[model samples]
Target: MSSENRTAGSGRLLTGLAWAVLLLGLWLWGREITDGSESGSSAPTTGDVAAVGRPPGVALPAAHKPLKPAKPQRVDVPSIGVTAPVVARGLDTQGAIEPPPYETPHTVGWYGNGIEPGAPGTALFVGHVDTETKPAVFYGLSAAKPGERIRVTRADGTIAVFTIDDVQVFKRDRFDAQKAYGPRDKSRAELRLITCGGAFDRKTRGYTANVVVSAYLTGVAEPRAG
Candidate 1:
């Protein structure tokens, strides 16, 4: 995965005061929004939505209302052929929400310390785009278009379904941690699937941007038996 680019900055560049300053810029990297999570922010206008390499919203389904809280156990993005475990993770010492380790590239990391999936607020799920030797769970995530369904199974016998809203690829320098990680409409349940994308820099061995698949709660279903 393009860790360096998504996180933005070489370890050497982000040191001492500069590192703290960098962290300050990426305040949302902490994604600890709870009691103070904003509500009812204006929705993004068509003009406000930015598109990168691929077009957004290809075959998306009808939007569904938000549901009650359910502890997500796993996530599946059929459009991307992804079905991976969702593990809880927190911010690192560098103040960035850590991704699943390279060794567990296929696993997805949920900001467990923050909002629960299908609940009001933004539930973040991150996965590796690639590993040193091969592609990871979200390697094809950037290609996800509208109309696709993302299902997250909870500990209970339920699944929270989210529909693709639009895809945004934020450059490392332009990434807005708060805006990107927070719920757009405070009353709604939103989901963000993030991975590294854009050009892969051989120097850093990471991508130059982050591919964020923005989605909203659309439907729920009974858990399927294995």
Candidate 2:
């Protein structure tokens, strides 16, 4: 993880779709200790304000220790013909992960700060569905449906296959935190791919909502010897 927190910058990037799984107390205490700023009456924004500080009425859920996935280093969606190398870097000082070349046309992998991709908990993977001018990596992602396969090729050459469970679109302002970040049955692992969706919002330079595809791990394979 990098010593410098990157949220101040990336937060602005995913202004439409933001999530914070880390406990609220940890967030508030960290802010006080690191920035020396007293808490204020800041209403939750469309994005995850859980990152900024704990919201007044929302109490952080009980923490659940995450079971690390096999460490997915590559992302491949054969259904939509997506093959991209993953990048590992602390997206923000708060410990949320960042995807690679996010500002570019193609990149895949977990944002390092949040749950690890393929991990037991809900792992978040995000990409631009479409840029302001060009088609982006996940532009076709909305077409993927339940039962489609999403594979992650690890650095070690192993691959994990996950079956898509559901896909839905949500208005940015009405995005449900619990549905996006709340804890779930840990017996089975889940994955979430989020990207800008719906219409473009000229006022905010953000999408009107987000398209999310949820999947569950079905298989894991070790690197094959050549």
Off by over 4 Å in 1: 1-25, 29-63
State which candidate has the highest TM-score.
Answer: 1
Put down candidate 2 lDDT per residue, 1-226, tens digits, no spaces: 1112112233333444333222222443454421212210111234432222223554322222333445667787889778776665444556444434547557754645445555665666776554334456777776676667787775555576777766666556665645554335565566777665655444565555566677777776666688
In order, the Cα lDDT scores of the candidates are 0.65, 0.54
Model 1 per-residue lDDT tens digits across residues 1-226: 3444345444311121122223432565454443325310011222333453234435545556667676789999998689999998776675566667656878988876667788887788877766544567777887787667899999876899888776776565565666556567777788988776556555654455666788888888997679
Give the clash count for each candidate.
Answer: 9, 11
Model 1 residue pairs with clashes: 1-130, 40-186, 57-146, 58-146, 59-147, 60-146, 60-147, 61-147, 64-218
lDDT (0-100) at residue 145 of candidate 2? 62
The whole-model C-alpha lDDT of candidate 1 against the native structure comes to: 0.65
